[model samples]
Target: MTGSGARSVYIASAEGDTGKSTVALGVLELLAATGGRVGVFRPISRSEAGERDYILDLLLQFCSVDIPYEECIGVTYDEVHADPDAAIGEIVARYHAVAEHCDNVLVVGSDYTDVASPSELSYNARIAANLSSPIILVVKALDRDPAEVKAVADVLMADIKSSHASTVGIVANRCRPHRRTDVLDALRDTGVQAWALPEEPLLTAPTMAELREALDATLYSGDETLLDREALDVMVGGMTAEHILERLGESMVVIAPADRSDVLLALVNANSAAGFPQLAGIILNGGLRPHPMIDGLVRGLRPTLPILNCEHGTFETARIASHTRGRMATGSVRKIDAALTLMEQNVSQAELVGQLDLHAPEVMTPQMFEYQLLAQAKSDVQHIVLPEGGDDRILRATDRLLRRGVAKLTLLGNPDSVRRRASELGIDLADVDVIDPTESELIDEFADAYTELRKHKGMTRDRAVQVVRDESYFGTMMLHTGRVDGMVSGAVHTTAQTIRPAFEIIKTVPGVSTVSSVFFMCLADKVLAYGDCAVVPDPTAEELADIAISSAKTAEVFGIEPRVALLSYSTGGSGSGKDVEKVQQATELVRERADDLRVEGPIQYDAAVEPSVAATKMPDSDVAGRATVLIFPDLNTGNNTYKAVQRSAGAIAIGPVLQGLNKPMNDLSRGALVSDIVNTVAITAIQAQNLKNGK
Candidate 1:
């Protein structure tokens, strides 16, 4: 995480049981760890609903939040519903009062106790906007379909966007194991980072302490530790001894009349037996206690189970027990630990924290950059093809992309092998177009066209036929024939193998002689484009100029303002060499070609980025210290520098995104994760969109 240094970030959801507290606890811990004054503010308190609002207590227990509980929370839901305008004003006033003493604030959004409405999203978005904070939306995924989850998110996000609020990320908590992938798939391309949290049994199961509180039962016997066990199931003791013995199981809470001596003895004997599971506890119903003789006998037996005596009748006690669900209150160390662990494993700290504008100048964050790429790609979904469909990563990424509707896909592989593998991974690829190159009807036509296209280079028709059989060539043929808008390869293949077909078939766009590449370098608080990192080694001054121009345009296409920086060992004529001279000449050419581009030249990497360094080196340059598009003088320098920043700064480098191709095509790193592939495909889709626009 960059820093839990954000002043305030609202965690919002319209549905109940969103496991919002667990999400809030995780974000709270991060904010608390910042070692600054951190606070939690709930815009609407749940205390007025006859239930204690423990979220503030849970966060206030941290050593960093010194404010009292009353100061951190705003008015109640009833108050808000009564006077809408007055409620927002009170929430703002209360939130600012807390913020005045804190370095960071994590605002918990209001609960929608009423029926779901578009006004719910609007109301929360308005409050958060008034608080001057971005949002992290939470969605409940326990029993909902993936599409339903997406629908819920779409509704909220649309409202958030229209209300002029923004979300850095969305979390689907209580997501089922089988539905995890599907939830993520549905949530993708929402223009924010998304994660699916698996259901944690402990967080949802009722503990003895919770049941005792809810029932208002008096613990007549056994020590306090006995109350810590959970009631995984329930049983009634009005039945016979044989029936009670038959139902013996672990973590079972039995409700029996205080005088049911037979059933009590049977349960005790079964629990003592080697094969029987221990009981969670026993409840003595109807305000009755054990007989003197029975009590002596039970004391002599030395049982460890706790006994709670309830004033309510048997039916009422049983009903109360059945309806008690778990609540995470302060001082319950075990449940809190489980909730924190669930959040830590499921939520992405890096992605969520990276979106925070914790520092100065409100830099373009990685989340902003990624969301722009995904939104632009999905705005006009493009048809893309993958050559390495045999790879599991490709199949998994394809499932996600298809589910997200980011792009229509065609896979070049043997259908049986691809389907078999997809089935093993529980992925449904029924909608994807699978083309076996050997059996493809277009293979002969592709071979003939290829032979003609390369005939001037002494290509033979038989050789061209065999070359067209390769999946890479077959995919290139698809793009050349306009069957798909773009292609992404190189998961199992090398970079040269992936791009060679494109270079031969699609060639360069008009007026583009040199092929170059750029990596969107995602740093802690900002996203920068590092160019010529994967292509055109030792580029001439003219090629360098072209790379700079293309990189700036790519930056702009995805919403980054382009301030071009041409890097070298020197800073503004301070050093003289062939490298420096080439960079200086490239800078002049960039300014000549792009009269509107803000460019700084022959600058060291430090001077190009750090404001203090820029102030010392090139005080008057506009691009110095503020460049979003960095063009290295050569490929070796660009590649090594990007890798260095990626490793040393823990930045995400999404690229080797190839430019200058007439058709949109990209090469992936062989070690790419499924997420990496998804991002690259989206980048390619946006590139295809631009190419289609003839930009």
Candidate 2:
């Protein structure tokens, strides 16, 4: 959890037979194969003869270390048992041990009965929160019903949201080998990250070899070649005979023709009843098909099942039935292929955590911001500052944001002026607090604090107090003294005026040496983050390193993992210069300092994004060609590149979302749109929640 580019991943499930451990093992193996130092954690287990140990043993065989099974999962018992509150604490502690030994730890879920027992459905969520790791859900595709799977997924998502845990995605294991498309389609409907991992053919057909080898050459009337293969979802049609009826239980047999009238009558009777088998239907062949009696039966039973007919003899139908088994047998190779495809689309653990934060209960809907024209929604600490205090648009927006729960309203102007402007514009500010800057209750308080903070700069309290009289200073002071959680005011003012106060009063958070900004480059289905565009003119290696970390954190806030690529003219070893060296050094510094972050750089845009290009230039580098967070060495590069990507590539660029501040503080471009304001507000509120959560 605390090593270089190595973060802990927690896999869990809300239901039984979800295949949590198996999927977790496969993910650990996949990441480890990519040169990641991985560790496994099974938070709780109930085993009789240490079967869990065997599973963990298999995991260690693929990992870089040989940790004990106990180390793999923090807690284990002989039988199924779990204590809700204690399980989370114990699991986190256990994962901490494993995480200490490796760069990342993968926590696997136990049985659903165990995960859901003791309390209800809080087990897996609690574990993810306790460990602060992203969660991967394992879904089993045994029943071949997408709706069933979706129901399970819905419960899992709700639980994850409720527990405030970071859930990365989901893997559907033990899928029918050839039904990947169907299962994948089903998973997509859930609106959650899901993959159908293949079940091995050999595993599915454990008895195939033995069955083929043991079969007597003359046991059946059908050709042996006809029985060579089988389908998984097969149907067997048998002519209703006394011998077949006795042995019908051996297969999914549908008896027919023995009594067209009786069978039709029975079918009609069963058709009207509920909970009957969804049969492949009955076949009446040989020209002795259903008569009027059968016709009546067929018509009546049509609602329940379908019926098919042919001119072929009973022998042909029997032959086809025998061959159905081969077609119906599920294979494992297809499952493996699907797993690989899923692995290709797999999002990193960090991305999932960020999504959870975005969807937290405290967040406000974008519509709320749009209706009111407020840029952000804040919960618990709602009071905000409006720099353009007398504007009617600000008042209306304030009311909207307030009603929609964006934040508490604080207008920075005279009550009379704001009210008169609202009346002129038919806007209502009845519930909004109009803080006339000249008569503000906190103006004197801010003046004193301002003087104290700037006292050493040769400025007297009078000058400092005079400077503090500005609206920006009042807003900045409110943020500093906890009167407000954040401030969004740059529309009617220059960037300098909006940011200067924050730089002077709010200051950067500790351990973050610089304040930087990034742009959220959004597309229809994806987003890429560009950083160092607003601050740090010509950052040094150390400063660039800080930019990468800060950018990744910012990307996380917007529901993306920061796979940072420190951009330069060349990738890998193509070009050489101090600028390039700075980028390379900055990348290394980021890796060294933030072991938990994933970043690679000193690479060109192509190499950082194109898998083939990256593979050719940096075959062994993990971040190359898969970078999500692009770190620019200087403000010029960051700004120009992001603008190009936005305009030429048709990417919808959002932000200039300021990062590394003590609280949420954003700068709006003069040309920012209403939609942009709404989104900025969402991002800010999400950031506020993250800061509140201390991440």
Candidate 3:
């Protein structure tokens, strides 16, 4: 099972003793041997020694993570007697944490009783629902007649294939050697995807050395000592700089003497090498002095590799490396390898999108599934509001989206005036809908509509009437009245002004308590959604919970299963006071109310992001280290923190997508360029669809 990146395989069972864990472990072992990052999570593990811990120990041998086991498994319940809902909550929390560290996670199932009682399986399915992981049902070949197997399989298949599941497949285990072909054919005939275990015994144990080699790096430094060579990609530095560049191209750790500038030059050259081979870092010999330039360059590229100044010279290091070669192929590759295998499984419509910003060219280019989804979405037209109507950039962008069958176009300006400007700018909008607020069918309607809606809200009829005449308010009203599906304004408005109309007329959806904004912060490896950066100046604990829940939902809508980290100065009871108390309370509230959400907070940004930092601080908290959704305490913290990460870390900030609105209407910054408008419009449209469906 091989692919470009990690893929996940979720495991369920038709009945107890189906051997889902054994199969999952086997797959994990196989894949982890191929230099893949694998992770495992049991959405429901009630066994005295939960299956998750077993898998965790196995994964630790191959992958690099310092998070404690308790944090990785959010809640541990009594094996025999425990509340299923409570168990599900803790399991989802833990599952999200593990899923964040790797590309794919193996979702293990709870126990399965007889087919006479489907509730047992149903409880496990609900946990999968909460985690939002794809599923693979494990069926026992023993004790099942053909009819019973098919019936049980059919029921499990339907349950796993509900709308909430991202994808699904099947694994049939331990078939009699002679009946294997017949059983496989029968299972395949059920129209459910399945994998049959081999008659030959499969070793499910993890081989550490194999994993080390798979990562294509040396065991210069690691937690374990039994370094395997096949799993080890030992980085050997030729005594010269040119060799370092040639051999280190995106490989692993490099060992050399510090006194050699030639070696330092080689170290520097290795980092800039084509594809930037994964240099674990330089292992300096004889504890020699490093050049200042080399030190600075290495510092510039930190966390990727660390310069280890050891007293041992090149000769001793080589001897250590030589001993590690044959042991690479030993560890279980289940989690990571399963993901790679599953990625190669070729499930239709399960597109693995790159973790980049929407503004990136790669995100916009239509892939097969995306093209089909967008094409089908064409019938669902949305009303788009552009602030500066006649600019070349705006018109060109609008034309491209329209030509691509994205949405029905609506330009906000006088038809004649816009026509004159479009002609001068050489932009064509011949068939686009051009509305002047002064003469708009919806604006005139919204002006009176706004007056009626806000008449009793401490505003006089004349005051409300005049306010509706304003562009922002009018634009928002059109969205509220269903005169338009959604609105995108603010090219000429500030955050307050653009959002004012929403606050005044549109307001929050009826049940929603707060209106918060989140910016989708995209990086090379992952996409994070940060909230309250553009709304809720200083939110209370209740408001913070609302923000976290809202942001989590938004992340789900964008194909990101959120691992929310509620950020603060402290982590996991590290600090005390009302501030920390607020965070703690909000975290509990989220766990209680938003049952499907995987959220943790009251953590520092470092603990929330860096696994190494998390290992040191709040090592037992599930949300520490691998959090994808970061919720800030107040606007001061949230706004400044996101901005800092963006500038300092070169993170791509997208959206600030306005949430808690009755309609999917968003405001752009006045300084928003044409591309920003395009992205905002896309996000607004998606939200509009979700709102209509009552999601």
Candidate 4:
């Protein structure tokens, strides 16, 4: 359990067919009932045909989770089998990607399949340990004796305990009704929480689709939707029609030769009878098709029953279908509801949820950070204006922003040109507000307001009118007069062009002197904040301290804990230079002015991030080697370093998100992608939210 307010648990089984999916579904339902956002993850899936994982798909369909299907699966079992070393890292990375946005995630481990290695248990343990997730192991106790089941449980418990993952509880699935009490008593002294789930035949019955796949059968006639109907058992129609009618059971798939028209007719009649059990479907073996008259008669029924033809003989098809386990289909409400109820009755929901440890230290991975940004932006809708609306990337991002309901957009451009470009891109702009700054009706009003604000610098209204003609200046005026909540530009313009208007109009926030910017450096594993990267080329010691404070505050807004690291060429007192002294002075000033902040001074790049270097360089400093916000000494170093890391390491750099502004005004790189624009727009919206709440 962590105090970070995010929680996750890993569910694993000792072997294949242990009813793990049932426990996973039950847990997901329990968590969702609390009204918190829940997510599901399959770290190692067995889906080889490029089809979606059945468990993952089922959970997404039934649960209230809002993420895409592909986002829930980490990697396939074959990928891990081919290269175990590299696959582990990919699994953890992908899990973090999906887990960041969820309040709680139920991680389903791999099913012990034949294609997987014998060391699968070890692999699952390693995965659980890496994720720091508590384990809820599910063990099968159907066929084995009570003592044998106890032995298996003991070994699994020992292995999990040795792996350093806390075993929260164990669910003994499919235990025989007669021996369930004995099995529970045998494992009572294992020193761990355990539940014995009795075998429920209905919960394990295969659906008609599973039978068809297992027998490689062809559907001769039936509605495709009825394929999901559960078959309680397989009955062979080897006797006369009258004899087969007497043996028919509820939800049974009758297996016989295709030429057995009498048996087929009798089964259909039995399904129609109110007193008899409903026939799930019929499978004709020996590669045989029914007579045309019989098929016509069956299809003539008001509600057609499923009929499948297979090439195998009756015994072979029956053998295959018997081995197939029932799986809950995506929309099978009856089966899904039954499975959830079964688990809810047997498993201890309160105990399992209590051990999830929701407060664990929340590590803000890149994916989680981006998801949080979008989620925060949507919480309170904000209107933002884009000055460079002529750019295709801006227009495309506008489409996505509006489609997702993240923010309301107003594009500042020539309306005709903007409409023409949008048409060429096949984007709809009906919901977006397009404004041509030169022809707008509010031009005079905006010009008058701008002239009043800048009248001390220049005493002419003509100059103000011309300045307002520029889109950047006009957009900034909209923010100044509260016409828009935020502004984002610079896609096809310079940073100065975008920020100059903001500086002249909105200025800096109160008690703040220097205006600075920070780029959210999204590395593969974590997200870091790089400050003073785009603005403030050179600054005095006082200006540097202000930038550090502002950068730290900016990081907090985006869910990052700020440990400010003042980067310099020298580490502590190791070297003497004018540049190094400036950083040292700035670090001291930040500490004295904001005593609550964790500040470290004159630290080298390696010392600021690498723990080993910090131990030798500055062991007593808290921010050394663990910095989340890096404050650069000058623009030359900050800009070059950010680009180098971004290009060399393939890191995603978001912004020059401007800080210390009275209102939110951000700048973008000239070669920004559509996704970059989308992210910047979302960031601006969130910043607007903060200002609206008076943060």
Candidate 5:
């Protein structure tokens, strides 16, 4: 694992269904990208007669490995059972054969078909030693806590050590996502390289093809492509058709007796109707097929699901389908992508691959960036308040944030209403602190503080009481009084309503004269910071300079190294309009104040971002063509540019991240998606971290 010319690593697991194949595929992807002719090998095949092993097939299909299924396997499960000693030698010999054909080889080890048999770990360790490959241990952590994960990994490492097989790394696969950080910390205490990939439901949820095979069912009707969609839930169609309508949801597979034509009609009509969830499929249970007449009529409906018929009773069919577990097999494009991305984002990859002599800075994919952002936020958990809890987007985001251990949250809304809405969405927000501003004991105290702060504006206690009842004002008071770390609102309110409280209560930090914002423009290959898009309609030269300085610092806070560009319709003095002069003046002020910063002004957007365009426009400037932070001259230009890029390039604009705040409080677009709310909350948490450190 830590030597030059390192060629192989054995991906071994102590348990079956541990998702070790997914881990192997992820490592194979890293090795293949190292510019080598990579090959794959499986020591013991679980495959049946005249078929390839599913995991080996997956590695060959999705990765750059070119070896055939038949050539990759050394022995069958039966062959291993006959002579365990002989199987180890054969595995080594087979690995050599595959290794001879390529520059590197990845060997997948045994699946502990029976966890009770203590010999699987021993067998894998001996085989790994014989093959002279470093072992990367894969452990089951699906429902295990940090302590249990650590205890299990330590025991495995000791056993592998006893067998004299060198251990390189460990992966806690299918870990509880909320405890992701704890899992890594726990594994690292045992002193091997470690990482945890969070559990994704879709990866384990059985698809229709799996259900069909489980029930031994035949497709009676519908599109073939629908068979790959993962089942979200299973509903037995025993209830009346009207009751079935009550439980209808996305990706459901309804089971019913073949004679229940009413159930079939209800599902079919729901599919055609405007207000129903898109069904995954239906399973017609009980040894009877749908009547020929009923089947023909259902076929006339649009967007048909995969209607399957099986020869089992409804109870027996449901049992079979429920027990079906999905594998990382062929024809699942989405699961493949998700597995690779999840592994890629959550590993100590450089250490795992460094021994193979691969070295390059990875471009931060959006998935990677978001992962890092959440990790940063969770490093020091912050308390963030959501004033727009009535918005479903906010509540959903709150659920995700809590589940990921990203923040402690308080929602500003009526407790009953929030609880009722959360129940409808099937999300548990029971533990989240709810503050009904109107009914809070702190209302009187908060109103008193508000009146005292705004007395010069003719504010009285009675007037302050009314203002504090508004969620925004109350939430800001919570942050200002050190009751919460930050606040994210405006999903249902306007920007003015969300931040006006912040402007009055929390105010600006030291060295910042003007309040501004930056939208993290996540492009395909890189992320750029676009500034003052959602604030500051117009500014004088001095104010624009303050905006640039603040934006550059904000970019740095979020891991973007700032090379500032003051944008205009000009490029480095090529134009002579007043607008160009304004940008030029702001540029000078930025340089004079922040001499350590790399900044350029009167730069056109194309020249600021496009290297080819910069070559002819401003080739001599260090900030041109590679700017990470773009400072706009005015609101009209900045707002319009960010939106156009967001729509045209499909870039994710993850802000209006407010800068220059004493404490972190942010606004959201009214049309924000749940993902946007989650990201914004994370940003606020990170900002609170910086504030806590007095940065």
Candidate 6:
């Protein structure tokens, strides 16, 4: 669990059909439960279609695993078979690409589908060893002798050790209930940590989708939601309807001829009744369809049974269903739950998770930052107000945020206009609260509150009422009155228009001399905080120091270890000028006020980012080239530099996240994308959380 870089574990099997996916799922769940942003990779995938790997796709879809489906695969089996050497190179490269951004990665080894090559097992070992990942070997043990289990473990351990892949543990899957203890003992005697998983019939039975795939069947009528149902047993409807009905077991798939409306009707009626067994599906053999009258009757009943028509006869269809294995579909919650429950109950999750080295590195990637951001925002849901409700980007982001359940949103605009725009854009705002600032029932009360807060600034009741008509002031007042936890604006308004009300009403936090902002520069490899980018055009030395301190705190809040760098044209007094002297003075002020902070100042950008350049420029300073929070001397430099990096390096600049605020309020660019709006909203929600926790 403690490593210098991203830690990875590879799950491999010596032979095929070992149910390694179950182990992978359990591992993913354990890692996720422990607050790990876990990623998955399949080194050599067996899927021929241009689709995602089934197990990896399931994890991404259902487990809240923050990884792309394409990122989960390395290479296809055909590509590997064509050129093994090139395939290995590509696989290693892709695996590292995924592993670099994750705290922990679950590398799934190849499923030995191609038996033409006898070196498939060795190939898996080679891939695992090359990646420097620890291996967890899974072996099938159902109905096998203890001696055979031991032999498999011994051979696999030898091969893995020979290939220089460390074996952290071994799992004997599908072992019989009575033989589990003996098999586990045998595995442990081989000097490896071991666990035995009993054979689960529900896991092995074919699902509706798998049956359809195997028989190339067509679905005539059934609920689409029932397609994930598992066919636990197969029954042939060759006998009379009453006899067949008596023979039907729980979750049975009935295979009958197309003309046997009596059998089909009996099954359907039984399914609809209370005490009878529920059929998983009905396979109509011989390309059969019910009679016109029976079809109309079935349609009228609208039973929830999934009906499939196949060309094969009753016995052949039954045989095919029996041989076919169940597959985990994208939305199959039952099987996923079963897998997780099975592993959690059987496997030593604490020990297994502890064995994984998952220490994150000093630098954070964009994906990691986004994942952490979402997780942080969801930790405590907060209500956020968006003043630019008429903008498509804001509306779209509102929809996404609601869908993800990250925050509660209140859009400020004319209610009718907001609804019309949302409808035109095909966005759903049913859950969002849309308010008209002028027509609100609380206008007079809000005017009174605003007058009380701004009386010293020469505000009157009439003027306060007029000012409250503006959506920005109204939204900011909502924050001040604790109606909403935060506010995000500036998409369709100037920065002054968006932030002026906040500056007047919300004000700055206690002990904060200046209100500043920081942009989270999401570079390709790591995230850096660039401060004073969108606010504070000019500041004195003391104010600059405050910005540095505030930016460092922002970095810390977002999981970046802040090493402050007071950036300038000079490096440690190498040059003399007004700008350089001001930067040096600010650095000294930071040292005086925040002595505990690690800071270096009057450093050039090259020295602050390039280690080799720092070695020649300022070698003795800890933050010379490893600064995670960069404090610019002026707004001109900060804004231009952030933009340059954003355009040239393709970095995602995720702010001007305002700092030093009594309550959380953030601004966005006029050209902000929907994703940018979503991220900004999440950031504001997290800032609100900080205030709630009294951080």
Quick one: best lDDT, which candidate?
Answer: 6
lDDT tens string, model 3, 1-695? Answer: 11223355556775665655555554444333222245556554443542345544544443323345555554444532456566666666566666666554555565543222235566566666666555567778765555566677777667665535533555666566677666667777766465555322222222334433333434333223222111124455754676566665322556666767677665655544434443434555665666788666545553233345566667776556545422112243222333323323322222222211011121211121122234334546566666456554566557556544466667777677676544322234767777777665554566677777777776665666677666667667767777678887767668788777788778887657898999987654467789989889888889999899889888888766788988777887779998899999999989999877777778888888899998998678676788878898999988888889889876667777999988787777766765566677777778877777888
Per-residue error at 523 for model 6, in Å? 3.7
The CA-based lDDT of model 6 is what?
0.83
Candidate 4, residues 533-573, lDDT tens digits: the string is: 98999989999999999999999998789999999989999
TM-score of each: 0.57, 0.47, 0.47, 0.54, 0.63, 0.59
In angstroms, the error of model 6 at 610 is: 3.7
Count steric clashes of candidate 5: 0
**Candidate 5 lDDT score at position 586:** 96
- Predicted candidate 3, C-alpha RMSD: 21.0
What is candidate 5's local distance difference test score? Answer: 0.82
* Model 1 ranges with Cα > 4 A deviation: 1-361
Say which prediction, candidate 2 or candidate 6, comes out ahead on lDDT: 6
Q: Which tens-of-lDDT digit does each residue in 144-224 have in candidate 1?
A: 999999988988899898888888889988888889988999999687889888887667667777788888988866556
lDDT of 2 by residue, 1-695 (tens): 33233476667765665555456645664455333345676666645453545445545654554577666766654222545566566666667777776655666666643334653346667777777777777777776576776677777777787888765677776676677657777777766666676553322321222233322112111122222221222233343443333332211224355345565455434433333322223444454555666566455543423344545465655455444322111222222223333443443434444433221122222222222222223334445566667643455455445434566567787776676544332234667777767676666777788888887777677786677678877777877898766677766778899888888888888888788898877542356788888767898888888778888988776557679899999887788988888888887888789997877778998899889998889999888988889888789888888888888876677788898788888887766654455456556666776788898
Pairs with steric clashes in candidate 6: 1-357
Worst 10 residues of 5 by lDDT: 356-365
Q: Which stretches of candidate 2 lie over 4 Å from their true place?
A: 1-381, 392-396
Q: Residue 11 of candidate 3: its Cα lDDT?
A: 67
TM-score attained by model 6: 0.59
Worst 10 residues of 2 by lDDT: 214-223
| Candidate 1, poorest ten consecutive residues by summed lDDT | 359-368
Question: Per-residue lDDT for 1-695 in model 5, tens only?
Answer: 32333367788988777888778877877765553456788888877878767777778853333466788898877877778788777877777877776656788987766332346887888888887788889988987999999999999999998988978888998988899899988887887788788988778878898898888889888777567767878889899999999998877779899899999998877865655777778899887877888867777664346889999987788888888887778766556656766776787557777544333234443544565677789789999999988887787687667666789999989987786556434356767988899989999999999999999999999999999999999999999899999999999999999878988888888877788899998765477899999989998998899999999999999888999999998888688988889999999999999999999988999999989999989889898999999999999989999999999987779999998889998899999987788889999999999988977
